[model samples]
Target: MTLTPNEILALPKVVLHDHLDGGLRPSTLIELAAEIGHELPSTDPDELARIFSDNADAGDLVRYLEAFAHTTAVMQSADNLRRIAREAVVDLAADGVIYAELRYAPEQHVAGGLTLQQVVEAVQDGIEDGVSEALEAGHAIRAAAILDAMRHLDRSLEIAQLALDNRGRCCVAFDIAGPELGFPPAHHREAFQLLRENHMPVTIHAGEADGAASVGEALGLGSARRIGHGVRIHEDIDGFGTDEVSYGVIAQHALDQQIPLECCPTSNVQTGAAPSIADHPMHELRDLGFAVTINTDNRLVSGVTMSSEFGVLVEAGWTKEDLFEATLAAAWGAFLPYDERADLAESVIEGYGIDL
Candidate 1:
């Protein structure tokens, strides 16, 4: 009783934590890179695809991030930004994703003489165009940008203000990304505070390369609403043999606080956060009443989709109940406003109606 990737897609799901530049089509990158005179790992499309897949499987965060150089290099222009954003929406729609909060750092795209406002505007224009194209083609799509501040840099507060400035127009949330260890959320406390005062939502990357202490700082210092790859919370669990005692203070707090963990299974495996999807602690975290949502952290990098991700989960022994709960978890944890979030939730449930 196996199902195809398209079958998993038809189940209706929400993507809470996917990156904009990281999900580009390999062919698109090949063309865009050529247009900008950017140095690519290989000129051939198949070679380029291999480069991305290998980097994602490189087993360390720093090595795994080398592939982004090509994506960011070609994405600095208004035309490129708009095209990629439009393609992003169309791609997500094809994968059966109804709503998405795609994130990228505006600072990175400004290298080509365009200002941050121009960058934001370009992305918004492309998103609008893509959604328009999808509807004309009779497909559903809703997308908003989440401006991420690179953790290794010190411009997060600036990025936070930029996201706040574009709140209703294009930006939906502020996220912190980059090397997760050493650079704890405390480093961006100012940005988090700015987001808090402005009532802007914030999601922090934590508990992936680092440990639970880093996740604790993200929660306590950043006041993170949603945690990216909080898989390391498994470190806090004890009594590994029989009746494993995972009821520690932090574990209990996460369950009671109901913070959603953006569990990107394949990316986690690629980045060495988890050995594999089955070895991922998502099952334990979900069973313990924690909100565990599935995601593709980087589609092109990992060579995955929400569809492929679910198929992998099913092959790893996830049942229909598991799929349903994970889908609902992702939809609920989406950064949408209450009404839109509710609409998405209703849409997911209704998708399961009149079974095939």
Candidate 2:
């Protein structure tokens, strides 16, 4: 049976690559900005939402990142951070996400005199509160945090250590997110090494602003088990379906190793990584046997949800089976332990009533 948007929303989904700051409610931004005496681009909630969505669609990664300044500006306090984190889970649960890993850079929130550990704790408290509320509301959702270090900065090791410190508490993994062109994952080699040595999970932002070399370094040097926005890995493939069709070293390694690509179609198009959702390489990657998963990299900025992302894939010619496959891939690619990951995958399969 073909799945409608409502059916897709009802399916148990796993989200691995959503940003915490980028997913704030517009009303919350207005309220938080007012409390902090910070000026906003727009006072009306609808206008502010439109501004974020429009600014993020500026045709390149650098411009797309500029939109975060507004969101991160108001997220500078403990209470505001807690409220945003809690609300993010509530929103995801309402949208039918069963599991999620919300990522944010603690360093960005320290401008208001909060330490990195304090910022993490605040977000953790918010996540717990949100989860409890969702359970009480009968949503049955779970969430974990992923600490991000700005790739252009020199604090990756510190962030990695922080993630290690909070392994089973709230933080589940470490990531480096920023402009990927000049700041490749190689610059954070020490941080990645630390996470690797400590047996912590790592997912690098690569192949979004840059090309296949970035993805290669993420997999080889950064030791990323999953690639955030690895859309440009398509650059490593040649002559699709032609007699000359072949995988370059990086693409072959990613495919052979089953490395998951957190493919965000709307965000990819907004950042010009893909021409459009219909033209995204996710379909090709899945067809080529890569472990590809769908996500909303930024719900507010990209104006998308997990269900809407699935709808985009469907409009791009994906069937319910393909959506189910992506959900299962996300469950397996989750940073949870093996048994827990397996259980999540089974739950998703049962939710979809599939035999995968």
Tell me, by TM-score, which candidate is best.
2
Candidate 2 Cα outliers beyond 4 Å, as residue runs: 60-63, 241-244
Q: What does candidate 1's lDDT look like per residue over 184-280, in tens digits?
A: 8888889988888888987889999898887778778788888999998877677522365756666667778888899999999998888878778
What is the Cα-based TM-score of model 2? 0.97
Task: Write model 2 residue lDDT over 1-356, tens digit each, in one string.
Answer: 56777888898889999999889998998988898788888889899888778877777556666668888998888899999999999999999999999999999999989999999999999999999999998898889999999999999999999999999997999999988899988788889888889889899999988999999999999999999999999899998644476999999999999999999999999887888887788888899899999999999888889989888788888988898899999999999999999999989999989864
User: What lDDT, from 0 to 1, does candidate 1 have?
Assistant: 0.84
Count: clashes, candidate 1: 0
- TM-score, per-candidate, Cα-based: 0.95, 0.97
Error of 2 at 36 (Å): 1.3
In order of listing, the candidates' clash counts read 0, 0
lDDT (Cα) of model 2: 0.90
CA displacement after TM-score superposition, residue 191 of candidate 1 (Å): 1.2
lDDT score, residue 233, model 1? 83
